[model samples]
Target: MKGLFNLGPVFGYFFRKNDPNRTSNFNLRTMHFINKLSMAMFLVGFLVLLYRWFLR
Candidate 1:
């Protein structure tokens, strides 16, 4: 988790330096990907909670 947190700036540095777009597009794509992943996780978690609620 700690390593994962630290990856953001490392990725940002490379994304900013190498990309001509200055990380704007990089940030947008990253956010979009994260948003999708979070939604997927939320759906799975909601299903699990619903199952457990009915089971109880």
Candidate 2:
């Protein structure tokens, strides 16, 4: 659990700091947007699967 929470900052440090595009800030907002978008896609796919399962 501790490692899971720590992973983001560690990754962000690399992606935002080490990457060539350093103009962007390294913080939680970017991470949150990414997470939300990914979760939304997963939810949409899950709902589609459930609808298909019911049709069968």
Candidate 3:
């Protein structure tokens, strides 16, 4: 239950080197790329929302 609040793994995902054992393919690569993009967009939106909330 405690792991849910931990952010180490989330940041680790962006910083860690690629696993050599994992198979590289087009679909997998595209999925990972999109996943990263969505996460980034969500974070940005959350920050903007906070900024607007504080200004009000």
Candidate 4:
């Protein structure tokens, strides 16, 4: 149950090295890129909300 909400995978997604054994493919790479982008946008939005809330 703890693993379900863990942030480790989120951090790992950005920091982990590529696995040499993993096959590189166009679709998979594109999907991962999109995921990273969405995560970045979410983080930025969250920070902006926090800033506005605190400064108001």
Candidate 5:
């Protein structure tokens, strides 16, 4: 999983639509939505665990 961090640009490429003039399609929107949701869920779960650990 250490190599995953190095692939930031690779995953970033798919997350963004290079053509600004092009209309947003379902696939593109779905990819972005899933990316955002996963990040949010990870962040929230991390914060909860972090605070719980601190209290222990």
Candidate 6:
């Protein structure tokens, strides 16, 4: 956990200052994609539950 905290600054620095022309890392892109998908799924699930409750 402490190591992650230490790397926070490093990641932040590169995230801000990295070159756009260079090919970025796949790992970060994949994580972001999954995060967005999970969020969308969660919202859809919540809406379904609400609709069921209203129908009840």
User: lDDT: which candidate is best?
Assistant: 4
Q: Between which residue pairs do clashes occur in model 2?
A: none
lDDT of all predictions: 0.69, 0.68, 0.87, 0.94, 0.78, 0.70
Q: Which whole-number lDDT from 0 to 100 does residue 21 have in model 2?
A: 57
Please identify which of the two predictions, 2 or 5, would achieve the higher TM-score against the true structure. 5
1-56: candidate 2 lDDT, tens digit per residue: 76765656645544563445545465756885688678668768988999999987
Better of 1 and 2 by TM-score: 1
Model 2 accuracy (lDDT, Cα): 0.68
Give the higher-lDDT candidate: 2 or 5. 5
Candidate 2 regions with alpha-carbon error over 4 angstroms:
1-26
Candidate 6: Cα lDDT at 56: 78
**Candidate 1 lDDT, 1-56, residue by residue in tens:** 76765746544543453457555677887986786678668768989999999988
Tens digits of lDDT, candidate 6, 1-56: 76754755534543565568967689987876686678668768989999999987
RMSD score of candidate 5 (Å): 4.2
Worst 10 residues of 2 by lDDT: 10-19
Instruction: Give one digit per residue, the lDDT tens place, for model 3 in 1-56.
Output: 99888988777877888899999999998998898889889889999999999987
Those runs of model 1 whose alpha carbons end farther than 4 Å from true positions after fitting are 1-24
Instruction: Indicate the worst ten consecutive residues by lDDT in candidate 4.
Output: 2-11
Residue pairs with colliding backbones in model 5 are none
Residue 8 lDDT, candidate 2, scale 0-100: 69
Score every model by TM-score: 0.52, 0.49, 0.83, 0.82, 0.59, 0.56
Cα lDDT of candidate 5 equals 0.78
Q: Which ten residues in a row have the lowest lDDT in candidate 6?
A: 9-18
